[model samples]
Target: MTDTSDQLPVPQRIPSGIAGLDRILHGGFLKGGSYLIMGPPGAGKTILGNQLCFNNVAAGGRAIYLTLLAETNSRMLANIQNFSYFTLTPIADTLSYLSGYSVLEQEGLEGLTALLRSEVRSHRATLLVIDGIVTAEQAAPTVQEWKKFLYDLNVAAEILGCATFLLMQFEEGPASQPEQTMADGLIELKVRSVNMRSIRELQVRKFRGSAFLEGGHNFAITQEGIVVHPRAEAVLAVSPAELPKPLATTEQPMRMGVGITHLDEMLRGGLPSSSTTLLLGASGTGKTLLGCHFLTQGIMQGQKALYFGFNETPAQLMRKMTRFNLDASRFVAAGQLELLWQPPVQDLLDVLAERLLNAIQRLRVKCLFIDGIGGFQRTMASTERLDLFLTALFTALRTLDITTVCSVELPDLFSPTVTLPQTISGTTAMVENILLLRYVELHSQLYRLISIMKMRESGYDPAIREFRITDHGIEVASTFASAEAILTGIARFSTVTPGVPPAFETSARPLQEQQS
Candidate 1:
């Protein structure tokens, strides 16, 4: 065996060519360090290895991808060509593939080692990737021979100044004998199905020379290739330019008409532009109706809008809204409104974010509404995952300066109110405004109430307004006066002393009493 440490000193950091992944490694991979990538079938282990080599070659460095299990070079080239960095001649020159299946199947470790050594020198390879170590191991007649082969391969990689990558498929337990011990670094790719949706995660089990980002991180497989999300950097210092400037007290208020004049007046115009608003209420509280009105108004003003409905199908939602006299078909036919009715099994937040991005790009969407958050939460088994998804979604949407409205369901109005579940509190806390809708009882009758809970950038009436869902959609009646505990979804008449007469008293009782 050769002295591995004395072979070649580590080179400077090499770019992974993946933006987010590079950040996780604090820059990029160690230039000349050999690493092991272990995962199950279809974990994207080979694709990641190919991406590393492709990135290096694209940046003027030489790389070689040696395959052991498969010899489909043409298919590999075609698959990789989809990426923006892929080039035919340059890639062919800089990147070469030597298959071990041919040599190992024909002769053994002696022939395999001979072929690898020849390719290492002839190709002038700087980066060496072993497609499947299992194939090489299976070809070896004995365990001792397999160990010797890996040791020789490592020594060859060291002497040649090539950064090596060994691909291994691991089962439930740890990797078998010499393979795990011989590797300098280890990365495990895990794909788990959570709530019937597949989530890809990556864990750096070991890194010899440098520290790595601890724990697993979310990743996605896009048409471009595998993209990993980098760990969020902490903000320490901020310049004066980074600090938000105070808004002028006399700034003109921008409005988004809700397609109802009375509702607009109640909102002192309508919803604000470039802000996140939440419509909170229980079932039958006109939350969907309000969101529909917002989208319809945006369409009328020539600004496109997108509505993401998780609970109801598009047809069902349209039919229901028609009963309230909202003609959504006009906006739909005009291509100004995009309605996305997704099943609860789907990741609604991801779908919503994707559609929002597309709409903003194609239609210059000014308003985006996620009809109800409850349906989204029900699909996600864990609150932490839901929160993480929403945080990423909201951050992306907020950066586009798109007016966003998220409707949330209230199971019990009297329950201690929270903007969102504990898992997603970080997301809900960032919302700029909240519109609270509730059903109240007054004079033995149930009446609908609307109150602005919070508005960050604009002034809004604090008083609760009486509203009803009618044939013309939601219309605000007169503002309630001398009312206390209105937010509790209940109201009572103010007490009058013996000598004092009541300001207003109806001889007829309300609908609640009639129903009773």
Candidate 2:
């Protein structure tokens, strides 16, 4: 038999009271791990250090926040006193704050080590944070001395069974830093500027004795503290076919109607269940009202819905819905539909994704209408990652069995061809169905036309139809002439023979079920 006495079952973890943080850290920090948190000034290093101490002490465990040649303890506390996490009562018992500048100056490395050991052991600290640790590096006259001090701190922290965090200002090529090699993990925070906006992001460069999610993740410093928003692509990895069919309120079905009888007919009875659809249109082309129809139809089926819009406030959307007699207030009052309006402002892509997903889970929503999907492009970290980001988002929604309809803005109607941003051109495949809504110039009047561009999993009507937005909402034409019908259609794409005119088909095409 193997000698398993020294082999522990699993490493214990220290929970950091940060939202979405433990998930990225693979269940928080290893109990005896030593981590280096490095970032530039105003990058949230001091706040994170103090917040972690507060979190650890709140859980009945002791924590120590030590500083060497840095701001005094009272000043540090004053800075973070306004945060909600600050507790005045706990500081007397479970938490300890001290200055190590005197010991470091008097006895150098050995004296500093002795002070740390004595304080941590006396308080029985489970967590330790050293703020402004960069001072120690500069005080050391040689590289070897600095390396030894870091090595000693790591060894002592492990011996005391304390998870320690060493906070310092951002350094150039941090991977080459001495503490990086000695510490058990490295976390770097940055505020990156792109165009006129600045985004805060975090990356776990290294984590020992456990597996952590790699790559950069966005974070925000709020009143409570730092909140991490991991990339959706890394968190939601289920492929389309692999996702389970969703409808938490009812048994799985094949199709759901969009509330418009004619549009449903064009969609082969209704849109496919648990599928994503893109409603592409120019401004004032009735795309938003069409999306409202999708949401209302979902509520009629006993499914909850969400209308997430960027440009329009909830009041504006509610007014528009009322104008079309959608009973928007009743649905809202009954909790059948929710309107989440987030302006196109200082928001990160990952942050938006996390919030949307959380709302879906909270309300058990089955239908979602993302009014103006193009709004997401405004804050994407990079245009190239949009495809992956959208793919992951769609995958997560599908896995939850939610049916989503997203609207994209096209150029002005008078333009010969609508040109979309180059970034959005590649995301066409991310959605299951594609619908086109355009305004047609016919006989000095603008006629609204709707067409099914593509349906990956189902067959749909290929012919275009004229639709009108009445006070009662959308109404699609029922019939077309059979005399070379599709060839005329006001002559834009329809080819008219020199002597012949385009006639319409009067009969309806038989609709079929989606592919099983």
Candidate 1, after superposition: displacement of residue 411 in Å?
A: 1.1
Off by over 4 Å in 2: 1-7, 239-242, 245-253, 415-418, 481-516
Report the alpha-carbon TM-score of model 1 versus the true structure: 0.66
lDDT, candidate 2, 331-443, per-residue tens: 99999999998886778888788779889989999999999877787778787888888888887888788999999988777554657667778788778899988765543
lDDT of 1 by residue, 327-368 (tens): 777778878877887775654333344444566778777888
What is the C-alpha local distance difference test score of candidate 2? 0.82
Clashes of each: 0, 9
Winner by lDDT: 2
Lowest lDDT 10-residue stretch of candidate 1: 502-511
- Candidate topping TM-score: 2
lDDT of each: 0.71, 0.82
Please state the error at residue 192 of candidate 2 in Å: 2.5
